[model samples]
Target: MGQGLSCATTQEHGLFSAMQSGDLDTVKAMLERDPSLTHQTTAYDRQSALHIAAANGRIEILSMLLERSVNPDVVNRHKQTPLMLAAMHGKIGCLKKLIEAGANILKFDSLNRRTCLHYAAYYGHSDCLQAVLSAAQSSPVAVSWGYARFVNIRDGRGAAPLHLAARQRRPQCVRILLDNGALVCASTGGYGCPGSTPLHLAARGGSLDCTRELLAWGADRLQRDASGRIPYLVALKHKHGACAALLNPSSAEPLVWPSPLKFISELNQEAKALLERALMDANREREKNILKGTAYSLPSPSHSDTGADDNISEASDTELCCICFEHVCTIEVQDCGHQMCAQCTLALCCHNKPNPTIACLNPPVCPFCRSAIVRLVVAKVKDCDDADQDIGEIGSPKMRKARKSRNFSSEGSSSFKGLSVMSPFGKMGGRGSGRMAAENEWVDKP
Candidate 1:
């Protein structure tokens, strides 16, 4: 009884020491005597020999434990497998060995529900996270559990790997996560880091590089969290002015966003729908006024026949629109009596592209007067054809309110780039506004 007890004690002490110091020879010899010892865990936390070798980055000892008989997925008291330890320490070589040995990369700790990816991300271990993601993508069995799942996997706090990486100021990890299909604008909901996105967390962490990476990847700068705070606002909240400066767009730098084409397409659709409706209404009003014959005032009778007279030609030249210099200036900007051809006015309101700089965008301004145009008036010419001439105009009643505090580049944006800024008011707008050439009389706007 005494002799067997001594041998067991010797074996236990030798195994613990060998595992602690990464003694390859002693570990090998002990395994030779009894391979079953490979499955045993220490008294504390139930960490096995594999856990020890992995935590210590012992490639050779780790390889033997993995190859001999150690369970790669064996859980400690905390429910973290050897893979989790390897990932936390950023043991790249040991991480690769365990992955090849078929370690469960998706295992999470019982306490925090954190996956190996989360551990790698929290520590900014881009290399380890990449390996786990690569393995999962390659495995045919991982089709349902692909990179999308791993990259976005959140812990108990509802924080995804990206959120952790961003909060920790891991720029490379942020780039990797974004490149691997991580949702850039995903918010940390109520349960976890509430109302914070990766960008928000990056801002809070005050890492300019991380903030730039998020922005470059198309993160919404104006995405509001639960507290109604945008990412840029969050940066300011934490007193990260440099980060906020980058987020703040300026006229000097050209604005480019992640989905420039998409934003443009959506805005154009909205402008077309609203403008078409306004145009349709204005046309009906124009036709109604025309039927009443108050639509136009008769001009003084001119010399009949093709005029070769210099005075007649000179009279025609005075009516030519200044902007186009070819068409008549039928519409005039409110307040500022600047005039342009109705056709040019329509095109101005219907411009489709974002003005590269918000400050330089002058959709609501009269090109000639440089004054804020409130509304537009289209004067009816006695002989002008309703079907041929542009008959519709835009209203700017709401422009002052929407434009005053507008940030066109913000996530929830408001722009009337292609839509005419002039609001149509039929004949009411004709009084004292832009005048029809020659008569200088206020006329019904089309």
Candidate 2:
């Protein structure tokens, strides 16, 4: 009996080793020699060949094992399915295969009682996280548990996936989960701190990106945890000076995602990305102002992988914004066809902080024509020759001269729409003194 057990253990080790190293021929030969080897698991953890393949990103071996009628939902001793392992290790290929093979994304492990979605968010695997979320929309779990419940599903400690992602500093995962309807302000039971929201977790973790994401999704910075501490206090406690600067209740409010506008929801992906980047840039400028003299300093803005310098060169040929001549006109009022820079556009909309007590919020009006802004999109840059031709189409020499003079006068003063210009060293001398002066500052230009 002892000899037979020793031989079985040797075969199991070989099978697992073959799966881990992605040796397809050796796996096939071993499987052909012993058909039951496919079902064999490790003696201690009871991890099968499927678990090893998925964890190691051996998609070919995983596919072969699945095709051989092996259960994709096979759990190890910790009750962790191969799907969980795939997500935890960011094996997107294996994760997709398992999802297609009917693996359960809702299976909770024994460790934290976290599902594959939680594992994906916790491990900062954005691709795997998105895949699992996409699968959950059509999987049987969607019908049984409801999509919203699955998105905000809690673990043993009652921490939602958003809480985990924020605490782990997974900014992309946090954004993905928020876009897919994860509650931005859902509180946890015991994770990080009791009754802590995702924003609180982000603050405690000292992740400015994660905190910015949560705030853009309309997270309440003033919401306190069970211990009566807000996210600002949490950031200050952790000595995250930059984060604390942004979260300070007295500081100017950062812009939130423009979800209230119906047209914003209908924008194309490219247009949406441009607008989101613009919004983040505006907030970063505000944060810089708030942290001007502090010991903590923000890193320079990281440009997108798409060549930004090339875009900058292209932008130089475009028309300058009449509101802020420093920047190129990049945003367009779709309905009226008026153009402005992104900074001016954001200034028009984010003049006031959000008030949760108000049930109805008004849309911002276009600064040029005073018309309610119905739609906005990224202005497409025209070729240099085309722009020159368009410039020649102006009806009157006097009209062109008047427009040029207006732009020149507004060149250095970007204090449109109640945005007071700050001094280089954070001084506010000669600016409007009171709230009444600030409210009256947004006069229409001729």
Candidate 3:
């Protein structure tokens, strides 16, 4: 709300309606009779006709408003100028017109402290972002806010346009910001970031494409968050195995730094232990079957939940998902060994993206250890009743029937198949260094 808004009459409600409907002729005739109508604002939000025209991308109406020299920089209650509304709504044409009219590209929304480029990037408007970038070029005199200055400007959350685009899973916008020199690794630990890089955000978001784009643009894969998690760790904690696969140290070509030696040693130890356990379980089952003559019946063995209050889950369950304590634990997180029912795990991974359109945007994290879940293994624990029929040891690979499992070859995984249970961390996220356990760290234990 600015100059001439107070004195202008609002009795002509027809002007508002006409502009809203894009009735160009009606607006033209009314404006000819009373050229001052462009300066009047709506009674409620104090949004002038220019604001409405720009917000709705009324190109013809906007051109007419600019012709009258209506102040295009005027902001409404939220301190959102017309350019901000245009950028937020993906109204590229309106944005172009505003830039042509000398609207300040540097003015930010008062509430979020976001420049117009942040709005465009957050909403995934690549073209709108380009328009804002090209604004400094079209100006009469030179402006300080060039392509370099605008793309990297942080909001109240210290989130550059790149940060906004990365979190929102706008890969194209992210690329544009980076191409224009936006800092890819800027940290925003507090606000939306929760203390991680844009790559970390990309990992949590579960967009493999976005993660790749960030990585290709020099996003650090090994950079740690406040919790000492690299992007790969973040992905693992969140059950996005596919994401972890992209950044897993085991798969990538050698890094210049060779990573912390302790991680490698722990992974080796964890793999060895898992292989031993799985081999022992397999031998026990074979011996039991041979002694019982394959069909000889043995009495079912009864067992009770051990250490029910260990204050932790150790690849074990209580006949139920630990989170809900209701349904039988049918599914086990592959690497970390958290056993929860499929219903609970699926709900957790998909809560952020239930709809198919945005499903690929979010990767699920583990409910217990916050590790990225690479795979889910489904197998029934052997009960004494298995002696009555042809049964493999409860933990044997033959007894395991994988459902939705990507890789069952690792022994470190809850689902033992061709390989042993092993992880990057020695005992599922390290031997209790003030860290929650139960994440399979050795994704690659060949």
Candidate 4:
């Protein structure tokens, strides 16, 4: 027993000294003296000799040690494997060697629940990330299972690998995660900690490249977290001017090659596939509704009334919003001949405007037309709450106050009756006459 203990102590001292000096010869001699010395676990801070070699970036020592069949899977007192240390230290060559030797890519340090991938991502080590992912793909399914599960796995704080990459301002790492099916909007941590989505983290980290990658992966920048802060606001709060600028581009400018837009152009095959799926799902729903006769028909092009035809064509062509560039399935053509998409119009008219009126923004101009479009009527989604609100307030005190405030004629109560015109052009001629004209033209032509 005494001899064995003495031998173990000698092995530990010799190995630790060899690792510290990066003495490959001494390490080889010691390992030859006792083959078990390769597995003799003695870490200064609970890190094995492999961990020391990896952290120190001693590639020769690491290669020699790994050749002796030393378990590269050993973790330190902090549960950090050599791969994690190598990644953190930006030891790309050593990392590659270790990964090739079958190091655990998904090993998580107990301190932060951070994996080797997390360390590589957080430190902006693109080569390390590539090496780890490559090795994971080449290994047996059982060996790669941990990393496969970790793609969507969150830390104790619920932060996915994408979130860590974003938070660390690692644009390439963000791209890798997004390509590997990472969730862009997965929430992490809690309310006080903000429970930020990956977009939020990217914005906060001031990395426009990362933010763009997240957006290209279909992350919703407008979604508010538990604290009601969206990704753009998070960017502004964290002083990420470039990221915020990319997210909320100036309306006046045409947005020539914005960073987010540029980033989106680089989406990999998987991101494109995800987008295609979303678009296809939306199209499928639209087709189903059309078959059920619930879908609204578009105005036909057979109309001869030049003025009205021009208006309809212009409305149809410009119906798609510039913001999201999606077809404006629903619309609220304003009185000023300006036609805007439903969501933008609603946000402008009802939510942001002090007085909710058809002419709330510059005498009811069509958001698109910029003409003297009068308060014709609002076309809303079926069973829309806003439509209900418009109808329900006809005789309410609020309507009465609004009538008095707007100096509206109280003679026939037809003013309020026009509000019931649900069709797009129901009030075309008079106060609400345009509605009938537009609807009749649409219905009769089709």
Give the lowest summed-lDDT range of ten residues in model 3.
Answer: 253-262
Question: Could you give the candidate ranking by TM-score, starting with the highest?
Answer: 2, 1, 3, 4
- Candidate 1 structure quality by residue, lDDT tens digits, 1-446: 00011113445667857766778898888989998788776665677778777877888999987777577888877888889888988988998999899888878798788888888898998999899888878865367666577678878888999998998999988878876778878888643348788888998898866875676445766677888887777777888766665554330111112222222223344333333333333333332333334322223223321232233333344454444444445565545545555544543443212333342322344554344555555532222222222312212324322322222333322222322233323112222122122111111112
For every candidate, C-alpha RMSD to the true structure in Å: 22.1, 6.8, 18.6, 20.0
Question: All candidates' TM-scores?
Answer: 0.54, 0.79, 0.53, 0.52
Better of 3 and 4 by lDDT: 3
Which residue runs does candidate 1 get wrong by more than 4 Å? 1-13, 190-192, 249-446
Give the better candidate number (1 or 2) by TM-score. 2
The residue-by-residue lDDT of candidate 3 on 1-446, one tens digit each, is 23122222455578877877899999999989998777777775677788788777899998988888889899876788899888988989999989888898888777778888888998999999988887655553235555555667878877888877887889989877775667667787465546678888888887765775675444677778787888888788788666676656444321111111222123343332332232223223322333353233333323212232253333322343444444445556657765654434433321110122331322345555556655555533543344422112234333233311322323433522221222211222221111113333322111
Across 1-446, the per-residue lDDT of candidate 4 in tens digits comes to 00011122554877867776788888878777777766665534565778778877889999988887778888766788888888887999889888888786766678678788777877888888777777766666335465555576666577777778888888888877766556566788742246788888888778756765565445665677888888778888988655665555331111011112222234454433433333223223322333344232323323222333243433243333332333332333333222233333322221110221231123322333333333333432222233443321233444334423332332322322333323222223332111123222121110
TM-score of predicted model 4?
A: 0.52
Tens-digit lDDT track of model 2 for 1-446: 01011113576887787777789999999899898988887877778888889989999999999999999999887898999989989999999999999998889988889999999999999999999999999999999999989999999999999999999999999999998889888899978789999999999899999988888767888999999999999999998888888888888766677554566667777667866787787667767778887787677678631354345443243355665455555677787656676655655554233455553346666655556777887764333333522332334444444544544454333434433232211221222111112233342111
Report every candidate's CA lDDT: 0.60, 0.74, 0.59, 0.55
**Candidate 3 residue-wise lDDT at 97:** 88
Model 4 poorest 10 in a row by lDDT: 251-260
True-structure lDDT of candidate 2: 0.74
Off by over 4 Å in 2: 1-8, 303-318, 351-363, 368-374, 381-446
